[model samples]
Target: MKVTIDQDKCCAAGTCVLVAPDVFDQRDDDGIVILLNERPPAELHAAVREAADVCPGAAISVSEDA
Candidate 1:
């Protein structure tokens, strides 16, 4: 899977960080999401998907690799 975050739409809710720290983080200054691993390992896929779905700002985007 591939992941991306739109900082402009981000609300800094930190849900993504909470759900999958390995795949996402927050900016120190503004608390915006900082994507750490654009392509997370298979074991972490569920958590990554959850992070995207539960993001309050809807800034997380997950796309399957074709």
Candidate 2:
């Protein structure tokens, strides 16, 4: 799985980070979605997808490279 975040579209809602702290994080100052791991383990796929789904700004993208 590949996770990417569009910072410009992100509104700092922190949904991505909230759903998957292991893969996503927020910038301390602006609270933007930061990619902690571009290609996280398969175990984190579900949470990563959930993060993308719940993102208020729709700034998260998840792709399955399997």
- Provide TM-scores for the models: 0.95, 0.94
* lDDT (tens digit, per residue) of candidate 2 on 1-66: 888889999999887887899998989999988899999998898999999999999999888876
> After superposition on all CA atoms, how large is the RMSD of candidate 1?
0.8
Q: Candidate 1 — which residues are off by over 4 angstroms? A: none
lDDT of 2 at 64: 88
Question: Which residue pairs in candidate 2 have backbone atoms (N, alpha carbon, C) closer than 3 angstroms, thus clashing?
Answer: none
Model 2: residues >4 Å from true position, as ranges? none
Best model number under TM-score: 1
